[model samples]
Target: MEPPDFVRFGRAICCDLVQASRREWWLADGLGGYAGGTIAQCLTRRYHGLLIAPANPPLGRFLVFVKADATLHDNERNWPLFTNCWGSGAVEPQGLVHIESFRLDGSIPVWRFAIGDLILEQCIWMEREQHTTCIAWRLANAVERPVHLGIDLLVNSRNHHADTRPYGFNSIIEGNVNRISIGRAGGPTLHFHTDDGQLFARHQWIEDFDLPRERERGLPDRDSHFCAAHMRLPLRTEWSGLVATMSTTPEAPATDSPLRCGEMLNRRRAHDAARLTAAVTLTPELHDAPCWVRQLVIAADSFPIVQPVSAKETKKELNEKEQDRQGRFGQRKESVIAGYPWFGDWTRDTMIALPGLMLTTGRYASARNILTTLAGFVDRGMVPNMFPDDGGQPQYNTVDGALWYFEAWRAYIAVSNDVAALREIYPLLQEMVSWHLRGTRHRIGVDASDGLLSAGDSGIQLTWMDAKLGDWVVTPRHGKPVEVNALWFNALMCMAEFSRLLKKDAEIFETLAKQAKVGFSRFLKPAGGLYDVLDGPEGNDDSIRPNQILAVTLHYSPLTPQAQAKVVAETGRHLFTSYGLRSLAPEHPGYRGRYEGGVWERDSAYHQGPVWSWLLPHFAMAEYRVTGDAELAQSRLAPIHDHLLDAGLGTISEIFDGEPPHSPRGAPSQAWSVACILAAWVTLERARPSAREGMAKKEESRQ
Candidate 1:
């Protein structure tokens, strides 16, 4: 069998491919059947599909099972079932369609659907012999005559419950065979299963839905109904030859009745299946294979809906085919090198992830290309935080994105020994430092008070927990955050290193390093501890935050190992959580435990108390370096590695609840989360005490 293709677009993995009507997109495994949201919406219209799936691991195969105008239950008002599908046209109302599944065999679950002039037949084949499950879809010919038909597959596993209310959907079902009801304002509840602890093998489609009348082709209305009856057994034997046919009569020019095709609906089921088989066989060889193919296959078994198309295509796809062309070529280029799924829009994420996800995996040229792509975006020393989805312009909202660029640049240089590239990025690095001095919005203004940068007050949470809620900064350090200073110090050090390599401006290098040292000293509190911030009058919050850890972990810091140990010990005592370091300690009194209720309620706890899995690796590295305690570092990081495999399916999550039993929150498969893990792994393995001789040799070469 061919290896599944993984398409990387920004920070997502698109795993499987399917096209309904003219719209096209890919699916991810974790999001669960239709569980990945919005990523699968019709290209021509919004709100066309449903992503019904899980939020955590065991990213079984995702089902892009599609239907027209399905009536999904409305759990909010408990009202009768409502339709939430997209409208056929700008002014038309879409109708409701219904879908359900039943187990036909112990290993096969047959999917059934009823929709407007259409019937869907699908099944989950558990190929135990191959240790894989295959999800297959076949659309029966239902029209009276051979009328051209267009069908789009829409799955919404985002809302675990098949109900209309978004609230109930947010609550995760923790047990196997968890069931929920979708009833009208006091109507009978429809039973459904949220989790079935089985892996989905692969999604196999027998036929494509092709509707003629290109201009008139559109998805169903908003309120299009959706529901899935998950069966425990395999679907191969349950309803093998099940079929449904609808009778219809073609309306005359003056008639407004739905077009009918009575005789065509009664065609032989075997004939339909045969046609579908032919279509499936020929699809890969089609003149214009859909761009979603590569991504969908890779995402078929992972979380996060992956869109492999570059940020550049996000806008261009609105009107032309150029975006598709570019996306196809990009996918082809990546396929040859066994590259991981990547998204070009996220500069920081891509660069941060390049080494582990690409270079270390042996795609060196692609890694170089990714760096070069980001290098092109550097303007006046500022690398972009993200490339806008529509590709019009790049935004620089993040202060750390540029800093990470330098780190990634260093990593690239280490791997390729590319001094020329380092030299080229040096001036850009200088420009970024200059931009920081000039003060770009957000009191990230260079502080004349301590010579250490003072950032915050712009209502932006620059140090991650980046979500904003009105004027209330969630994890605000209104003056200077420890990590920002650490990065600033490291950036200067990197520039100094690069300058030496270029054999240029030794005096300038000394001056920059001196300034950085001064800044580091001033930021150190007189109490013999590194303060988390440099707020005046109010003084430092002294909340044990991970920001201070960077001061030791980064290559350049003025603090001695003893001081580093002090900061690390202080932070470890107060901030460390069993899962990872808490964004804020429980002692702060504002910490929230559970992260699954409402949006703000969840975000408030997001940084205030959440245990970020990504930070553990960094903290472990810092702890190891500070105390030279190999056992301590292993103790800190080992559980987290196990946790990643358990909760994230061999990846890492963005954040976890601050409280006990710290549940993972935020995006699963987050780029930084993965980067931090990979980077920390590299740090620990290379810096192991047993590797002391190797380290000495490496240090001598540097000297």
Candidate 2:
């Protein structure tokens, strides 16, 4: 299992501080915990850490271990193998210059450093389903004499969202030669273990570590880490590593020897291999796809995690089989984290990303589990908008999440054809429609006269363009938004189809779909394109936005062929960029070119001008639908292929600057951005000459 060529970087990239610091790598544990940092091995965001695990099982994350600052020691001299940005604007050690090359060895970030005569390698990864992180280092080549490593084990226990103060709490450190335990009293404990290393308990407060990225985001710019201990280990051609685990409760003493670093590497490699194999077996189109697309297949595996079920939710109707599974695996469900660093499982993002992140990658069980899990939280005809990080009740503030749910289910059935699952979930789907047709929360209900869904109020944003700061809803599209109604029409049509498949009455849904289609025509402006919102406080909004592209891209588009083509052409003429479609046309008076400044400033420009990668797929699909040119449509996605190496390393960023030379911004790794791109790519592939031929042969054999 070799990594894709596009992901590997040489000294030209790895040796430069600016470039290396911008390229981040992330690894997930499949339990909603992760390890990530820049290629420079410097902490940029407060979220950058070697170990961040859930203190409350999935979302209540705590950064337990900051990093293991490493130094290489030879006969007479030594050099630091890590980099740190100081508060006084100095980069000490400047360790990035020592790197010979950097590449993701199948999602694990590996860096090779030219240390005098020896080449040293370092890599970090997390164990799946457990709160354990491993950092392994090796002497890639032979050395003249014995070369040792001095590792300053920096540890911290702070809410991942909060900054730390020096000695904020007293920590008790007790360890022997090969093991160490560091934790604050009555809090989580971090157990550090190694196969071959000498550990010594030490305490020092390293403060004033500058977080440049946080400063850029207008946040607190300084942090501190407690040096809990130090370790000395000799590097060999074979791997030697340290493992750290967080125990929220009491645990038994460790008598077993730590697993060898080589074994851990092999386990991760085997898992990567199996994922690729299963993906190809399930979706054969990927077998001959480009390397970047395959790389995305590996990237897609990072978002879905096991969200622990709450005590209240677990008391819902459960069958014998469900109870047994819960008893064995603990009470947990599947969900997708919307983005890394500072996002929880958002329903809209999860459903919007489902087909791409799950179905396209042959993760049907995970897909079903995610849908089922979210289904349990549906209320007032809407799925919970997001799961709060503090383990509070799920928020239900979105008008389109439920609409996207219908589409997610439609995508699932299109691939799996599992009628039994559809039948089981159909009733709840019907209830969702009923709630929308009547009145639900947030004034969300179908207008009796127009049949279009209306939602939102003062100071509220219910659409994906949601960006708020204090009481100011930046994109408060408080009415029947173009995309929301488009989704409504699509959802109604989906219900009609699902009804037919399940031997239920389809006439009502069919009639509603017809009514919504008729109502949707009001969005078509006389000058072309569609309105951004209708029946708002100020009447119809004529802003040219990417939201109207949904009118043509969805599975059950209500627009006619001519109308769809007009919308596509109008959007391309105004909003299309190399990376994605801009949120607002530059001609608009309110458009902001750069998504910079502080929170209020950024939120104001968030939907006003920034180009969203997620909408690029919608535009691509719309263009393909209108022109029937799958190759040309897929070419729209070309800019992002190189982008995989730029921002999040193998993943995609949440958004980009609306201007030229679109710089990646926002969450480094976004679920919808990657999901939408891969889903559109696979979809466009089906219309290719080769893919069509394959499908024809398969169809002929079935006949």
Candidate 3:
């Protein structure tokens, strides 16, 4: 896959190490595994590695190969080929000075080094759904001298989250004629097979590798790695020149060269692009959509992986209230890894992300598998909130997670028309509603008087604004959050509509939905927009937040058109930023303008004023509905296309600073962020000119 012209960087752009290190590249292996590092060839984050495999299905990630330090030998002298940061705060080797340019060949990271007249190219790629990594160095151009290269493999055997210090990690390294196996007792045993090299076993411990990014996140900043071996290779460009495989499994030495791997990688990208092209129905009409959208479709494919569940053993794993849900857990199902570096399969994020990531890319089978997988995990009428970091039992503390499932189904059924599948899950859906009405865990239940959902109690953060660091519930809109109720109302309307389609008792749901509408009316504020939360012990929260936009954007909005107009206008006046909608208006006293510093500081401002990318699509949709102008609404989302280059290479970020220029922060890659924008764009593409023409009236009013 040749690199996109716009994404490629030259020496002029990446001339400084600081600038180059800020630009990171990621490669996903489609099996809850990824390989990533900085463009400057420095391991800035602990996540930077050649192989970070899912040790247990999709959650237990182990960083097996940290990086390989190598040098280019031109007989006269040796040039450092890799860079590292030590605890002394010194950048060793300084390889960025030799890097002429860097680019992503599709998802693969490529670095070109120029030393005198000799030029060498290096790249890394992971096999599809496998723990195998191919690290290839090609001698692209050579001078009169015969160039030689020395590589030292830095190996680690620990969970990605935990750092390593000098320990009794006696990593046994054994070498054969063509292969070398490195084993850490009780940990993973990795095999390295080189196409052409003279291998020598060497045991050396490197320590105090300072991780700046980890320090920023308030983690152990110092790490150590075991250098397992050293190899020398004569530089040659022919065949898969100087190819090596560092993988979980043993394989024959590669004779097919790195060029062939490049070919296969390009073909894979082409196949991905074709799937997106076939899925798009509005291509000719909205033919001008930016190039990054298709890249997002490709990026979408990276997150979902096959998470096999044993239906029988789940009862022992979960609490007694989850017995019914555990009965059918044995299945090879699809689940999404929410993001790279750090995240697990989260039901709320997965459901909200499914349609845009899967359906929009015409990956119907994947979408169905994901929906079915989450459906299988429903317990006490609530879906699993998040799978713990180590593949442990899922936590079900979220009130909004189950509600999003109904909306996900609506989005899926709209495209698939899978009524048969709908019928199969109808009873489960009914169970969910009953559980919510009667009340479930965390005080999440329909208040009998208002017919509206009320969740959370003392010290419990139930809603999506759930950022609590050690009993400090930051931005806790515990009781009847605006978006939660909107979703609750939407879910009730869905139940009614679905009951009608199935020819079941629709009256109960219809009545409950009407009652909810009346209860929801209490949230409307005298000033404008709606209350952020209602019926709290403290009465009501009148923060001007983006949450109220959902009342207008959802499939069955309970708000009147006039009220919807007010919400949209208010959101535009305060919450809207070019990057996204801020969690709170900047005018608020509690508002934090920037997201930075350590973990607690960042989480403190997480929901206070950070602009969330996922909310942009909702605001965009609500604006379109209010103005009846698809073009204008679509234009609002256009700026995000340019943001793709800012962070995550070609995908959207989780959040940005609430202030102007809106620096991207949080998870560099996010599921809901990509899903929301992709879904919204597709909606705009399908939008027809309204029957009521208000373009001129809207323009005059704006003026």
Against the hidden true structure, what lDDT does model 3 obtain?
Answer: 0.78
Deviating ranges (above 4 Å) for candidate 3: 1-5, 142-145, 238-288, 308-330, 688-703
lDDT (10s digit) by residue, model 3, range 152-228 = 88888888877776765887777774578887656766777665677778789888887887787777788888888
RMSD of each predicted structure: 16.6, 2.8, 5.1
List of clashing residue pairs for candidate 2: none
Residue 438 displacement (Å), model 2: 0.9
Estimate, for each residue in 1-703, the C-alpha lDDT of model 2 and write its tens digit.
Answer: 4445568899999999999998999888888888889999999989999899888777788998988999999978999988999999999978888999998888888889996678999888887777888888998888669999999999899999998978798888877878888877767889888877889998899999988888889889899999999999998999897888888864624533446988888788778777878887898778778988888888888888876434345435656855554444324478888888788778899999999999999999888888877666676678888778888877788999999999999999999998988987888899999999998999999998999999987777789988988888888899899999999999999999999998889999999999999999999999889999999989999999999999999999999999999999999999999889999999999999798888878888999999999999999999999999999999999888889989899999999999989999899899999999999998899888878898779769989
Q: Quote the positional error of residue 354 for candidate 3 in Å.
A: 0.9
TM-score to true structure, per model: 0.56, 0.96, 0.91
Between candidates 1 and 3, which one is better according to TM-score? 3
lDDT of 1 by residue, 1-703 (tens): 1221221111111111121122123222211222211112222222222222212211222122233221222222111112222233331122212333221221122334444544555443221111112334445534443222122222222222122322322211121333322223212122222121121111222112222211222222133223322222211212221111110111111212222212112222232233223322332221122222211112212322232223343322333443333333243222011111222235556655555554433345555555654544455455666544233455656666677777667777776778766665566577777877777755555665445766665566665456567887766666776777777767767777777778877565467557766877765666655777767337776666677777887667667888888877767887777666787767777766566655567656666777776677767878888877765675665555444323223345567777667766655445555545545554555556755566567559979
Clash list (residue pairs), candidate 3: 239-257, 240-257, 240-258, 311-329, 311-330
lDDT of each: 0.44, 0.87, 0.78
Query: Model 3: how far is 42 from its true place, Å?
Result: 0.6
